[model samples]
Target chain A: MAGYKRIRVPRNTWNMWLWGWFLVAPTMLGLLILNIIPIFQTLYLSLFKSGAFGRGNQYVGIGNYERLIADAQVWHAVANTLLYTVLVVPLSVALAMIIAVLLNGKVKGTSIFRTIYFIPMIAAPAAVTMVWRWLYNPQFGLINYVLTQLGLDPVRWTTDPQVGLISISLIGIWSIFGYNMVLLLASLQEIPRDFYEASDIDGASKMQQFFIVTVPLVTPTLFFVFVTTIIQSMQVFDVIYMMIDVTNPAYERTVSLVYLFYNNSFRYMDKGYGSAIVVLLLVLIMIITYFQLKAEKKWVNYM
Target chain B: MGIASKAAKAAAYLFLITGAALMIIPLLWMLLTSFKTVAESTSMNPFVFFPSVWRVDNYTRVLNQNHFSAYYVNTFLMMFFRILCSLLFSAMAAYAFARLQFPGRNFLFGIVLFQMMVPTQIFIIPQYLMVDALGMRNSIFALVFPGFVSAFGTFLLRQFFLGLPRELEEASKLDGCNIGQTFLLVMLPLTRSGLVALGIFTALFAYKDMMWPLIINTSAQSATLASALAKIQSAISVNYPELMAASVLAFWPMLLVYIVFQKQFVEGIASSGGKL
Candidate 1:
């Protein structure tokens, strides 16, 4: 056994402190200058009236908010976003949970199945969207091809306003299911084997075992997956952007809040108003997450 | 213990097999379609999984037309530096949070945790403005610099580091090593699993990323493979062959990484999801 002693901070140790701060400083500083500061800048920009090239941003406090409240398009985008969240979160979580449960069985080639499911999770989003676009094509697309084989009329995916959001949401559902499935599967594995063994001893059927044991045990992971899915759906952009042609007639129905933010900031260069919209989106996310957390406590089983 | 029970097990296998097949069909279809000619690709009544006559030219055409080589190099470089920076910063911060009794450590960690909930979307506008102000647009740095710090990575690593047994650090201290030395030698090796977990995630997100690169890198040469894959659409008449070939190439590396490290990767993300 070696003698123990608390090492004193050598004079050079201040250099270590300085170096640690220095190493960590760029990142924290970047986050501040780039992220945190911009958050405030966006808030401030929201208050201002924009001029050409986003220059001469004059202050008109709450004026932008007033305009936004009265703006139907903003509300439409909000509704579209909320609808997307509603569509994606539950669909993603439930489907993922079901698949995870199905996979939790001591089946052969499970790892291969897990890999197959996770392919969409890693594939380039734009590429995946393009493939889906091809599939969604009413003419000569695989989806319509399949539908026609089933003797159904071809559905115009991105072009038709009625089915566009649903079509986009379908892709969203496909892409995210694997990630959630793996999450739930991990949670399901954590469930003590004894729980199932005991349930089986008590004459529980497979379904009952799932309900009484698996469901309760995996609720914590399920809640996590749910909250994250909701949060992700609310902020979703890449799929919608790549899937829906912004110039098409269906744009009105498909434009998400982030897409609208992108349009305002990049396309139109209405930086000030765009900033305002982002701030509002942030506030909305925070409030929604708070509520989700409160709700999770009621149903989530931490053990 | 009867033949009837054996039949039930077989049914379970059948259900799982169908589910697995459904999951793999799109990928298999994409691969098969990539080898088919334009006529075969658009065929309505083509009851063919394999191409009647394979055209290998699509891969060549996509490679020649797009500056794909440059994009691959740039994307990989971005991933390498981004991962390196993220690991270093996150580990250092995590170590401080886990082991050090510094002033305002918890408060600082709280700030990082808060930042995780604030979506990257909200930060993009302000981040973009700053990048524009710095005149770093269309540069690789613009693509990789902002991503160097990850709140989630720091938080996850902190959890892993905290869960580490303190005995190693105590022994190292007895050997007259300082905090930095102990962290470098003892703690770092002990937390290898967490590091690998962080690495896989960093690599996955960094490589698959499109939004930031799309916004930041306007020049084709500087853009990533993910961005390069989008070039398939700009050319008239969907070239399924080359497009699928390119998509396959783009999808292959990460797929290989995941397959190679499936156990660690799955376990890492699963546990991280639970903790975070």
Candidate 2:
């Protein structure tokens, strides 16, 4: 019988609607002006060529796209981006799963443990990046200090091109593992208590039960984390922005697509070329996302 | 059952404690370095816990030298306005999508969902240009405006609103309450957790935002705390202690907030992930 009554509006119905519209007005206006319009403008700007300071923009049909293909820097940025994503994503997700499983059991001071893991999640990225920058410093950094303590030679974390991407990935993993652990922990906990109980009754080993019950049930969340992490990892900016000074030797090896975009657009004020880089990034993201969506069915479990 | 279970639980606790220690190291280092003198901070020997000379001047110097107070004020203002706007806008749009039978409601809701997948980076350039066109560059509006329409918030609130029972709303309507009254009096109270989740998420993003504020606001007076912390890296070299001090001050409130709302954040993260 619930909700059977005729919906009679009050005398202030118009006012309610008005207020509702008003409440969303600024946000809607902002999305329109900032989000929608600028996308088109970026598209339009990409079709034209412009000089420094954005002067003398001339129309060129797909010429920017051709130039972008020939540009080794663009390709290097793409390769560097993929390398960063490849290095960071699997390590982060796997580490998160292990941590979440380890943390999922009944334990004394569970909340305290959760708080410790989540501290990094809540720590300001700039702060964490600064700390990581110090740790990655070639001299007197904690990381090198620890390495020397372990009787190993100190390696240049940011200065060496070969290790630079891996160094940044380590920071990325450090920042993201906590977040991914929290997410996977929720899914892990959702798994029925009876499943574990039944497995225990049947006398399966802990690792056996995890493989047979835990991993399969948590696959959906794992897949979700995987997709999101891939998408997010491709746009690496913060660690690079803070950790790698542009004047450093490993700058080219460490520059991501977004960093390159930032350099072209804001750093150098070459909006046209920057817009072209952005468009390529967008296309890259779209292709990745399209494949991810299509491939999600293969691994993602609904139940 | 009892003996083996207890043994397993002990092993689990040991693992969790190890993980906990690993995670807290960087943050603890930041806090420890904040109180260390310039000499001790970058010295060959790593100092744990108390410093040889407790130099509180690190904090004092950062607050005085770097415009920390203004950053705090700006960040606080940005978060307050951003949270208020997100709650209001997302709630209204969510209600319309969840309760009202409007044309294109489903389609519009779909658009909101689509927005969640499109990375905010894709929109940054356009958004920046838009802010420039609006002549609102270097203002608080630039900081708070783009974040107001949170598709994630709207989608989350919509799901929450949909999950709400209609009986209360019907009773309110029967008692001469209009749709607005029914929603306001009956529905709003029930959505407190949803609102809290959304509010907390918005506040966290607003607090931690570095990229947008760094892009738009060049002046330290109008800049956010995170951006100001980033400035410390570029501002000086070999001032690790002072930079760490600035970072500690910048992160303290967020850290405190996270600790206080730790349970809610876990619950929120869990539910929101499932919802996504």
B1-276, model 2: which lDDT tens digit per residue? 699887877777777777777788877787888898777876785544457877789889888888787888889989999889888878877776777754355666666766776667667777776677788888888898778678878888988999988787778877998776766778888888898889888988888778889888888788899888778879876688887888889888888888788889877766666555
True contacts kept of 1: 0.46
Q: Against the native chain B, what TM-score does each candidate's chain B reach?
A: 0.93, 0.93
Highest lDDT scorer: 2
Cα lDDT tens digits, model 2, A1-303, are: 345345465435655656455544554565666566667788898888776545688889788889999999899899999999999999999988887887787555656766677777777678888887777778877888889989999999888989999989988888888878888988988988999999999999988999998988988888879888898898888778887778989998999998888888888777788889988888888899889888878876787
lDDT of 1 by residue, B217-275 (tens): 87878888877665556563366666777777677777787678778877777777767
**Residue runs of model 1 more than 4 Å from their true location after superposition:** A1-27, A51-53, B1-11, B45-49, B235-242
For model 1, the docking class works out as acceptable
lDDT (10s digit) by residue, model 1, range A216-283? 88787778788778888888887887777567788889888888888887777777777778877888
* Interface RMSD for candidates 1 onward, in order: 2.6, 2.9
lDDT of 2 at A30: 53
